[model samples]
Target: MRLARQRAHALIAKSPADAVRSVFDLMENLPEVERLRPSEVGLVLVRGRVGGEGERFNLGELPVARAALRIPEGPVGVGYVAGRNRDHAELAALADAMVQADVWRDRLEEGVLAPLAAGLAERKADTGRKAAATKVDFFTMVRTRGEK
Candidate 1:
């Protein structure tokens, strides 16, 4: 089985509140908005695959926040994110709508997604560095009598 994957909007949806809010704050002419589905928190069943692509199993339930909203004059957007941050979810949905609009798409990409993506990349690099710092490598060598 295959799963559909998306990056940009997912990044936005999962971004920290402060990060998302900074982008939201930059918008000059946000259209009037309405909630198609109010932001809400719930639990979603997490599934895992054994050995990555082997048998699948239920991992557990995880908290998720989701929101669906629309610009009254334009596109609809949806957001789903891990954790229980309703505000983050709403902001993500708003960004999604903005990204879909021709007017806001470029601005959203430049002012919002670009910086968010850069920050995310930096964060990943920092995490990798931290993990590398703690990484331990082990090896065993057979003693040859001749060499000894």
Candidate 2:
């Protein structure tokens, strides 16, 4: 996934004007890719700043967007987006990693990784809520006969 994201990012950084479309296009053509449900994806708009040794500038924030891609028969969603700034490549790699991982379906690649990659702190606290609830405890519980 990281490789995929990097690919996406490089594609975008090389062509900022068509970054978003390029990402969507690549995902759309990926083999066996499953399109995420519309309700499963979320987006957030944010503002931030970039500070240098001599000056701090307000980098106007655009909507940092994300989409969920459902993996086949897997209880995971891949979150992704083409974000603002020159870190498009890094964000793409992070998104790809999240998507390929098993435990990160609910994660927002666009909101978190994008901003972090761009060297800005996240301005919003809204993480997307899960549409469905599931519980899985990795720890094993031991029981004695009398405990029942």
Candidate 3:
């Protein structure tokens, strides 16, 4: 689920206007929404553990944008995405709210999430193909006792 959200964030961040357009296309109207926390950019400390299981160390700071909003009389949703795109953050926030709304979940998932997932899958497959193109195979030679 986190990976799906991350993918959604990546898709939104890639093109916020498109995401907004898609959202509007899917839903005729949105309930009155209030920003619990307006979209803002900040740095988060990234911690890592050696080999996935060791003492944690501060890796670095990553720039992130986050937004929290709620539909009046409905669930509050939060969006946390990499980079500083306020529009992306806001749209993601809306999607999050819709996801929690249940009523809007199917529409959102079908119209927004599905397309983004498809595009992401396409890009990933393209990358894999390119990587495979450059793949090399190495063979080791075996010597007999009399071989020079």
Predicted structure with the largest TM-score when compared to the true one: 1
Question: RMSD of each candidate?
Answer: 3.6, 20.0, 3.4
Residue pairs that clash (backbone atoms under 3 angstroms), model 3: none
As a TM-score, model 2 comes out at 0.30
Off by over 4 Å in 1: 1-5, 146-148
Instruction: Give the worst 10-residue stretch by lDDT in candidate 3.
Output: 15-24
Mind giving the per-residue lDDT tens digits that candidate 3 earns over 1-148?
Answer: 5655555556666544565566556666676789986689999999999999979999999998889899864878788778777777778888777767758777777788778767667878999999999999999999999889
lDDT of 1 by residue, 3-33 (tens): 1124556778656889988877886877778
| Top of the candidates by lDDT | 1
Number of backbone clashes in candidate 3 = 0
lDDT value for candidate 1?
A: 0.80
The stretch of ten residues in a row with the least summed lDDT in candidate 1 is 1-10
Please identify which of the two predictions, 1 or 2, would achieve the higher TM-score against the true structure: 1
Backbone clash pairs for candidate 1 read none
Ranking by lDDT: 1, 3, 2
